[model samples]
Target: MQQPHDTPTLGKRAALSIAALGVVFGDIGTSPLYAIRECFHGEYGIAVTESNVLGVLSLVFWALLLVVTIKYLVFIMRADNDGEGGVLALTALAKPKQVRMGTPSWVLVAFGLFAACLLYGDGMITPAISVLSAVEGLGHIEPVFAPYVIHVTLGILVGLFLLQRHGTAKVGTLFGPIILVWFCVLAALGLPQIIGNPKVLSALLPWHGIEFLVENRAHGFVVLGAVFLVVTGAEAIYADMGHFGSSPIRLTWFAVAFPALTLNYFGQGAHLMANPQDAFHPFYAIVPHWALIPLVILATMATIIASQAVITGAFSLTSQAINLGYLPRLRVTHTSSTHIGQIYVAPVNWLLMICTVGLVLGFRSSSKLAAAYGVAVTATMLITSILFFVVARKRWNWSLPAAGALTVLFLMVDSSFFVSNMTKIFHGAWFPLLIGGVFFIVMITWEEGREILGAKIQGLTESLSAFMDQVLADKPQRVEGQAFFLTGSYDRVPMAMVQNMRHNKIVHSEVYFLHIRIEEIPRVPNMEKIELERFGSGIYRIIAHFGFMEEPKIATILELCKGLGIEADLETASFFLGREKLILGDKPGMGRLRAHLFLFLSHNAMDAAGFFDIPSEQVIEVGAQLEL
Candidate 1:
């Protein structure tokens, strides 16, 4: 085997940082399109006085530094699970293996799952708002283009979602260069304005934000719901850490994203200070007439890249949730063979597409969708801060005071934002919360339902050694071919095997009991992936270990077995799988509603044989009644 590589060279780091700008910064990169506009013209927006302009700019500035820079890039991004970041990884890191319900770890995991679910809502709203805001530029260009804004936005969205099937690996390469140009334009647009009204730079201080809040009093706090938009995509930075290592991401942010975003927002501030009436379209107003068309085009493409990042994030989180058993299995298509991170989930993609398009039609404007955007992300960030506290205490072994002090600081910021967004609960913000709530229910119900089903199964199945002894004593007719039985319980005989012995009264010449276990890490090494145990009389046990980011496949398991010097038949091997017929509330204790929901979810889940990539012709599914 080739030796492990050392730290990457500076040239490679620079390349990775540039690539990171595409996928990692895409969502946050496009914030300038609408973030500043919302703060001044949103429902609770204040008059665009110079001090107010400086104040709003100050708020946006500090939000990026404290929330995105200090809390996330400097801190939470360090909580990666074996080089993987995101709530899923944080959940695994914070929650130990085999933590029981009602424990702190268990509660944290549930919260983490809810946070993950909230991102889906964020995902749906992002594309609609991002693309609509960019496309809204057409309305600024000419009266005729204004009429077709919605139509053009819809067409682009449809095309974007349809492109998912072909995968984003190739599209991703173009994202870096395009986004790099977009950021440069943001900086360029802002520079001259800042030069003209350099006083807007005073907003860099914390006092202006405080004064703005004090002067506007209650209204200022409410407009914070809008100001939160500047940092709305902050979570994406941590979520994509696995794709680009943290160093390159941090480097890209401080070097490229931070400078560009700062200049643009300040530029917008400077422009607003001069032309207060342009508050409604500050981002566009700064554009030179000659650059307007090209800027709009770049913004639209940039927003598409933003939408692509979140959509892919939704896919990655969904896959991890399924593998970790928080959600039911779905059809996961690996879009790139070289990178496991590049995935396409059909159901997630279509669902997002429908919701996003519906949001555009229903909202009719980016300003309306903007109201729905900040709530989910603020709540998610709040949860992330809470989870980080637990991780620092439990994993890093930090003293309570140390953890509490840092956590209190984060919570103060998070709570302020969360409370501010709460005011808009009815003004379109309820949509994503409702979405998050429904998924949280689905996740918890499925987890509890599976536990109940496992308990029932445990009672029905006998010990493996005892079953083997009985089978040996019976001397049942040994079949001709190799047979594989997949089970969740490592030591208990599979229900399918039990059914086969009861009816067919025969065992295969070579019997393998296979149990696939998903570990908490992102990827399992091949050396420790598959473990085989030999039992006399042609019976064996095979255990396959996978990480939450990986799919457990039978072909891969068999290949590993071959590596271990256990060569089985290449063809004509039978694989036995259990087809569970769940009897809702048959054993009592579980609520009827949740039980029914779990049954519905289980029924809709993908088939085991197909999920594991077993040959259809060689698959045999034995039916069993499972009580929940």
Candidate 2:
């Protein structure tokens, strides 16, 4: 049954906002650690000067305002899918029920898929960069600590991933407080610097940024790729809407996050203007010498919180993909009894751990990873703008010109950042692109392979009405117990039922053809959850509707069916499921390489009985081999 999306009560709003600090703003929150430093020391870095500092500060200010504040906060967050927001949710909102290949709708789906793929790329880098950058603060404490930086980073990352299985319910409470203090400290540290160099406030003006770009031109454009780092987690505001409602996120950003980040960035610029050599490590330099170690410890905690948020997001995205059939199902264990969205996928967790650790050891420094960081996010932002336009026009009833104007403005900003980041492709930017490309291929292959396989399996089914008539004519012996045969489509006779009739020569007294339909929305209402059709002669068709955010529990489904006047006794019921074996051949389908890839994926996919929480002892699998 579809349940209404939960909304925090007025009293809980403050709490939710605090929690938002840890999850939604962590990545962007940690940017102050290295953003300004990168602009002067990264591979594409320029000299630190008065005008350059002002220009970079202005660029950072405006990028946050335009890209994050206006684009994501004020506008795009509204394009939610039943209170769930993300690239995939947006994809679901934009996709039509019947999308043919090579159509605009199909292209939109592809765009969403690629955006999601980029998120996995973003997911891998976020933890590596956030944690590494945080731990790198130790080097600022003492020159003696410099050599141990990589070892400390690897240890911290390993420990973090190891804690994933136990779930974050216990430690999660600390996230809000830690991140809150982190942001508060950011403002406290930067406020004094901004006051010292009051002229830095002029960066609030767009002309300074324009002048920087106008003067520096190509180099300034490249610097934008670094500046883009400040708003890297902007998508989190939208992606995590399902976890914390939009109101809390918006409130937290405007009230706590936005002001704190602005002060920190401007403070870094102001400090840089005063002491140019400190550009080597401006964020740590801004702090008093006595507080340096404490700050580093705090920064490490904040970064770890940030990494946890991204890892959780990866879990959510993968769960959504699996439900949508764009990826194979994996074992999903709910981490919290109170929250369905809080889950841990073993495969996703370990895969992310390997990649994140590899990145830390390879890049060796946060500044290096910064080179590859912004591309995937900018690409995702660009794609989001495009999808938002589609939703604005079709779903929101906005006029084409109106949606086009708003989208074009976002596109211009996103495209500029995307192009700037493009220059970093040779300087370690290829990593995310390669990761995104591999994930995109896998997602598309799974989706297309399912279609091909479903088509072939579909052809093997007999007409339900004809098959029933034949059974009636033959007067087959009736068994005592009820039998439920799961089928892909409601009108088709299940292959399991067909095979059972041929082998056993008896039909159960009460038989049901069960169809589970996974809907695009996050939740389906209970009234519309189940459709029970009595086809007569003890044969019935049962369709259970589930939202993407939900997992189908046969016990719950059967109970709901009973409530709807469709009798079901689970203890005596027999469940029949189909097991398809793929054989690569010269058939008119996918290529042999892809066919084998699909087979490998299918082999690893979680069994349907376990996925649906069916009783393994009561379930029977009817196997069939199909040439693809």
Candidate 3:
């Protein structure tokens, strides 16, 4: 039998590239439906004259080339942390090795966390906008369908989200074939328009775009808010890099997605140049009349795929957050037996569905939701640029001049987009800002609160050496079976062990202090998983390491302990755990309001036994109260 790694060939890579098409390009691929239309008819839209149309098209061309093609695909994708790419993963890599180094680490961490929060906002807006844009194409088929656009959009979105529980593996096989056809249709529909008026090709040069901005400086600046819509989903390419390696993502983008999108965009521009009256819905109008209805059906399917990508991304990000201790533990169900990353988070799923539907009902149109969409993505892009700068300078050992130069260019572009989208704050961009802000608060509160609670609790415990000597000084009744106490701090004795000795006055013949450590990386090999230290008097200390990508399972760790010469039986051994009930104090540490909030979070967090996969029948929970 051939090993998995030895089975690779060119065909496998090509297949992975095809699979990349369905999830990675869904959002940006659907941009042609409204990107060109928004340029001339959105809130900040300019006139539809020949010069203005070519100017806008020129700007779109370069934005895609520089921002998505060069900035992300060429540069940012090179900054992956241990094969994991995302705002959080990049932040973890960028964190300074020395705590006392220049530019405090907390500042970089804060920026990264805020950026992750904004992505949640993006997750909410993507489905609403992408699905609505696809369904809105129906309005062009018949004027009578205008009233039912929202109804149809909501139905499609609800049905799409409801299917998330079934896992993406089932339908993922069709994604490549479906999106492959969608891109072909985009190219097929746009080729004729591009050929009809070769003048649209003139917009390819940067001078046309620069001239447009110079001719209409103030209006052009505002128009960038609309123009930014074309590259809204570019970050998904980077966020999903771990799903399909950078090779496949890059090949798919350069070969298929980028070209099809550019042709379609230029085609829409050429169509407008020839017939300026079709500015209302130029994308569908460019299609042949007989193919309009079938095109709408295809577009709807593409949009659902786009929406599915974001929903799936939200689930993955939440799982990372839970494992990293930035959020409360929620019940995570692995939807696939083969792929550990294929997970269904019910709370995140339902919450996103509710918010996505509410956004559709509230905004009522893709154009309106577009106003709220760019801010989150732009903010995330800006933060990614910043984090990338740090990683380039610190991790890659790049010289100051080289790192500073490229980062400054990226920052300048990102800041321009950020400022342009900032103009729409009052228009409708407040929705994402509000959502990101709420999530940011919750994440920060959880992180900071855990640190303070850990410190306070650690202060109350004695050192492990001292506790061991005390136990030696006053010997207790020794039982036959082994006992394992799960603890957070390895330096201090676990509260469960202390309470057990105080009440029962007995210790197991073999007592093990097991500390489960979640590392910053994605996965840790099983060969390096367990570290054992035997203290005197039949007391042993074991530290088990797991990556953020691995679910911590106590039973697995216990089974592995046999290799280290520790005798254990799952049927007879007992696992001890501490359950803390947080009490809010009138002190000024976290303040009363935040303290009470942490208390509530602690009370509802998943118990350790369930989260660590410890069997309930072989567990003992000792309850205690801690004041914060």
Top candidate, metric TM-score: 2
Instruction: Show pairs that collide, candidate 3.
Output: none
TM-score of 2: 0.98
Give the lDDT of residue 184 in candidate 3.
91
* All candidates in order of TM-score, best leading: 2, 1, 3
lDDT (tens digit, per residue) of candidate 3 on 582-620: 777768376777777777777788888888887789899
Question: What lDDT score is found at residue 619 in candidate 1?
Answer: 89
Candidate 2 lDDT tens digits, 1-628? 3212255377678888888898889989999998888898888788988899989999999999999899998899888888888999998998888775567779999999999999999999999998888888888788899999999999999998899988998888889999999999999999999999999998898999999999999999999999999999999889888777878888899999999999999998899888998887889989999999899999999999999999999999998899888899899999899866679999999999999999998999999999889899999999999999989988999998899999999999999999999999987888988998988988888988888877887798888888878987998999788899999887889889888888888899899999998898988887788999887778999999988888877887898897778778877799999988877887637677777788889999999899888889899999888877
lDDT of 1 by residue, 1-628 (tens): 1111123689877877888898888888888888888888987778888888988999999999999999999999889888888987998898878876667668888889899999989999999999999999998888689989999999999999999978888667788889999999999999999999889888999999999999998989988888888898889988888777888889889989999999999999999999999989899999988888888999999999999989999999888889888889899998887755788999999999999999999998998888888889989998899999989999999999999999999999999999999998888999999899998999888888778777777787877898889988999999788999999899999889889989999999999999999999888999999998988898999999999888898888998899887787546788999888977554554688887888899999999888888989998999988666
How much is 252 displaced in model 1, in angstroms?
0.3
Better by TM-score, candidate 3 or 1: 1
Q: If scored against the real structure, what TM-score would every candidate get? A: 0.97, 0.98, 0.97
Candidate 2: pairs in clash: 2-524
* Candidate-wise lDDT, in order: 0.89, 0.89, 0.86
Off by over 4 Å in 2: 1-9
